[model samples]
Target chain A: MSNGAVILQNISKSYKTVKALTEINVSIAKGELFGFIGPDGAGKTTLFRILTTLLNPDSGTATVEGFDTVKNYKSIRNIAGYMPGRFSLYQDLTVEENLSFFASIYNTTIEENYHLIADIYKHIEPFKHRKAGKLSGGMKQKLALSCALIHKPEVLFLDEPTTGVDAVSRMEFWEMLKKLRSQGITILVSTPYMDEAALCDRVALMQNGHVMTIDTPNAIINAFPVKIYAVRSNRMFHLLNDLQSIPETEAVYRFGDVVHYLSHSKTFDPLSITRHLDSLSHTEITVNQSVPTIEDSFMLYMRKSDKFNISQHDN
Target chain B: MTTERPKVIEVKHLVKKFGNFVANDNLTFDVKQGEIFGFLGANGAGKTTAIKILCGLQSPTSGEIKVAGFDVYRQTNLIKRNIGYMSQKFSLYEDLSVSQNFEFYGGIYGLSRKQIKERTSYFLEKLELTNEANKILKEIPLGWKQKLAFSVAILHHPKIVFLDEPTGGVDPVTRRQFWEMIYEAANEGITIFVTTHYMDEAEYCERVSIMVDGRIEALDTPAMLKQQYGASSMNEVFLRLARAQSAEQ
Candidate 1:
């Protein structure tokens, strides 16, 4: 418990027959920018609710800032700032009003913590008189972040902050998170985007109520056990099936314009794949070794865990 | 080969303004038959506005537009019949069962009882959701719901389909599978107009148009755009264009 700013010891929760979380154990260090990377139904929201003291876990215990979530719920609420996935600000309230309202809730004034949200609030300042509901998607996200930081909480939890945001705005939002982290704020953010995993200091790749793996983005990519090759041809539609028919091919899936092919035998020759496709009348074929991305690592981990779960069911 | 295909969607100097704000400004493009066209832009960049006009959901302020050979201004009902739309936010009813939702959408599209029944069974088997037909939609996984929504959108055999961030929060494997489904549909001569925030998905499109501040800044093949921008990936190219817009403001 003393090792990190936030710690969970075998936290598990269930909603009726649905197991939203199972034996989730993670320790986030103080001032670390941690990411929970997963798709919907992965129990990210459930885990966040437990950490923020909004819901009690069915079993096990969790701690934030040396306080038990259940026993010290009030303290956790004071020190932790949470931005839910959905927009929670008052729709009729202007941007300035929302920020000041949030500040008042924490017994602080916006002027007292203006520096904390200055970089982000400035983006929405031009539209300070505009109603929150009238703001654009990107502007709404910034205002939400500003309100969440107006109270100057030590730990910030951003749940799917960039879920529906565009690529440009998503990039800009991440830059704000990086800047906040430099101020020694412990940030715990969750997102379903695999590409954003690379931007975090560390990430937990989760699926089906389980954390598949937790490590630095580079570490996870480097630890991929198999080599991958990018294969493309003029007929990409048929290239997927053709690559899978090869005896050495273990997995084949389309990645952008190319098909990522993994072989059962690592020492397999690349020329053999090209020759096979060539015989199948595929023209302008290019097969080259490619580095595995975080998305690739995530897919591989999900497959492994799925097989493990199936074998357990068999037993 | 692609040039030989007929145009399914054509826009000439399209413009849509809300009071003083211009949501879409002088947009012009053509979507060829069976082509998968990607519409990309930053938030508040007029993509939704342009899409609304193209789908006949809203009247354009001024422009010449044809969707599936139907005029946007005069033949809105005909345009609606020839196009299918699916979005991540609102595609299926939560309380309805899997088959019930299909039946409802099929009915809305004016399919006969027999056609609805046959197509419902066909798609359920294709998605391996035959057993889950009686199960409620909210009970299924998000990935399955997305796939089912896509299948239902095309049940009426519309000539063109518009997808708005269809795979926004889906897992990587499921996302790829959805793209494969898109490919299969396009092979059958369905013109697909898709908008996605994923730059990698942008690379999968036959061609893409990036909008900046209610106007198109770049329109070309992903390969050509990357080469022109001197960037390694579509993500870099987007950042260069979108960032340039913000820097000027």
Candidate 2:
């Protein structure tokens, strides 16, 4: 109750025996761009639904903008905005109608908050008369965001906002998010794209209903404990398999065309590995040390959690 | 890879007009056999319209079109039989179980019931969805659902498979897994024509065509497209082409 924009304290939720969220504790500062990143079934949307007052956590307490989710749901709803993962807008309504409808529902007029959504609205202005169903994926995304911001909410929750959008649309959308963040809007966006984690001020990597790590993107990447190398050769598929079987190799998985591997050595010599691979007839070899990315850090974290689970099972 | 004369698909002066709006304006391209071709565009960029025509779903307003060694207009049924389609929404039934989804979709693709069962079991086992056979589709997580939908799309082992944003809403890992499945299909000599908003996914395709405002703005391999757009990534290539197209207009 310290006037934090969003607060989730030891929240727990389950559907029958399947635990969706477990002891989730997070506090988002006012006007911070926070990201919840993980694969599907990672409980990101669950946490979002809880904090936004759409669904109640079975235990513990959560608040948004100084209002309790359960006790002050009405107030929380009034101040917060949410764009669900699915396209939930009225398909029969025109783009303009959709915008106005959402604005009116929030007790505001589109005209009153035109400036807030003008940048996005301008793209879809000519298609204002078109039905929401007819809009393109990118335009639909813009319209959804504009509708979410029409009432000028202090906190916005976007669940995988760029999931199906084109790469260009994704870039544009993130740029829009950054602009909104500059205007003092607290954004909590959940995405499965690890690259997008860099765009946020800070991110919480979630998995299996738990927050694995929370830090700035750079901090997260910097915090990766292992030495990483990008390894590619003519025989990449077989090379990855071999690297996984190596004693020194911690993780070996395909990263784009090249296979990225982590060695359990701070002083892992690049040429020695190259020569070793060369002896195995892996030609056109390009083995170089590269900085750990968000994916690397995420993998490292997942591996640790998996090891812990395995040990616990044995015990 | 073949320098031979017989192209798998050849489109010349293709035009598809929906009322007054021209969906495809004099588009032309050649798709080689066993090529993982990408039909890429912004939403409303006419990529879907062109693909629909090629798949013999919609008759072009006026064009010379040939697919799978047949005319598009007259041999539409044959074309449909020869090709498979995974729409952006896909073709999975929400009420069906994982195995039922395969049976239904595979049956529609004209596979024998026995073949459907075998393919279903093999794919389910391959995808590690053996335990989820009885689970309803809507009950499964999105990543699993997406993969299953794709598996059903290629269930019949058609000569070609048209995928419309197959990895939408899926996690990165799922998307990667989906692409590997696509690559596996391609490796088996199935011509893949996929449309995706994810440029990273485009890199998996052997060749891609970028459509903007009812016309192809660029067509090349991912590396070539990136180099032509003078960008480091396929995402930037899309941005540059889209921007260039808008600026030209």
Candidate 3:
């Protein structure tokens, strides 16, 4: 059990009629960067709250760094730094004051754990005098992260930390996380962004309170069953409808300028679709076999689960 | 796709300032009718300030701006009436039921009772949420709530809709679905002026403008921006521009 920094076994939680989590089991090894990838209502926040000792599961056992979340709630609180989805820092207080406050609560000084948060803190250090509320989205993210790490906890739990941040800042934040992982801090982060799944060492795709799959991002992507093709035409609006009408096209979704056509048959030829679009008078048609991304795999898994739910309902 | 779509939004030499800080510096752009214009920038790069000015929420320091052919300075009321807006924090009453939220927003836009009832049913069926019409807004999934908020924002059939990071925290599937709705609205000849931090989402826009340090660094279609910057993706293009600005700073 000590092999993993965090462990959950048969964890189930519910609120009245809604099942927040169902038979959930996951493990995060020491110093590993783990990601919970799902939508907003996918029970990510509930699981995070339980693991941080703010909420207890109705059934099953959970542990953080060898301490039971329920039995050793106090110990878990002391050793785990949790940055909730919402900005939890004092709005009226300045950045430096907030850092000092969090450090103080852990019975430590900023200087005592400065090394742990120095990478992230340095970005927001210039605005140390500004109120946390006055900072921009990206700056606030950094300040909140700095406060979370101010206590030098063994594990860091961040809930959608990079939400609403600019692309550049999001890339920088992930870099900072990788650096933190190098320093041997077990990080469990949750985000709704499928692109972010690739940044994690391993990610768990959760939906409707169930874990669909957990593996390295590469493995998850490679396991996509269907062949995907990226199709482009001058008239993108009409191209979508045209591709959907093709019998071979099983799933089609717009990805930026191109429509990703996922065919059910692995041997499906993409040229036939191009010819079909061309026959529809769609000009500048281009079709290429595309590699499946994390989002593609996630959507496939979601569709599979939806079928399962529908069959169960019919029964 | 056509260049003769008639400019829906025109801005020239637009500038906004707070004390000594210039938030929007001499920005010039024209958004064509039925176009999805992506307004992209880093934090504090003047995107929000410029959007507020366009929305007539704040008077610009200096500019010649026309939204839907109404002068921003003199016809602010007219501009407000002809436009819709949704912010990062979804503009919906969480305690209100889905149908009730629709009715309330429709009322604010001066919709008649009959019109509200008709449109409420239309949107609910379109979103496949007729079964959950009476459910409180907070009880629905984030994706559904976002689509509802967007539907309500456009209930008045505004000529233009300004979305401020509409897909900020939603999943990719939902984000894709939301874009489909936007495309449907755009097809109906409604101009979409969206500001987002996601560069990939920027690629969805017909044209995108990158703002840096209170000024536009680049503006073009995503393909052109990538080619101009010698980058593979929009994310790299944004990073190149943003990092260059940071290096200079």
Candidate number with greatest lDDT? 1
Put down candidate 2 lDDT per residue, B1-249, tens digits, no spaces.
Answer: 356634678899999998999999999999876789988887678887888899998999998999988899899999988887886475688988898888888878788988998999999898877988999987876767777877887788877888988876554555666777887888787888989876667776778899999999899988788888788777788888887765674
lDDT of 2 at A8: 84
TM-score of chain B of each: 0.98, 0.93, 0.98
Kindly indicate the candidate among 2 and 3 with the higher DockQ: 3
lDDT of 1 at A52: 94
Indicate the TM-score of model 3. Answer: 0.95
Better of 1 and 2 by DockQ: 1
lDDT of 2 at A284: 90
Report, for all candidates in order, the number of backbone clashes: 0, 0, 0
The pairs that clash in candidate 3 are none
Q: Which regions of candidate 1 fall more than 4 Å away from where they truly are?
A: A307-315
Q: Candidate 3's residue-wise lDDT over B1-249, tens digit each? A: 355899999999999989999999999999999999999988889998998889988999998999999998889999999999997595899899999999998888899999999999999998888988999977887777788889998999999999999887676667777888999999899999998876678889989999999999999999999899998788888899998887786
Interface RMSD for model 3 amounts to 4.6
- Candidates' DockQ values? 0.59, 0.33, 0.55
Where does the lowest 10-residue lDDT sum fall in candidate 3 chain B? B168-177
Q: Residues A38-57, candidate 2, lDDT per residue (tens digit)?
A: 87778988988888888898
- Candidate 1 has a TM-score of 0.97
Q: List the residue pairs that clash in candidate 2.
A: none
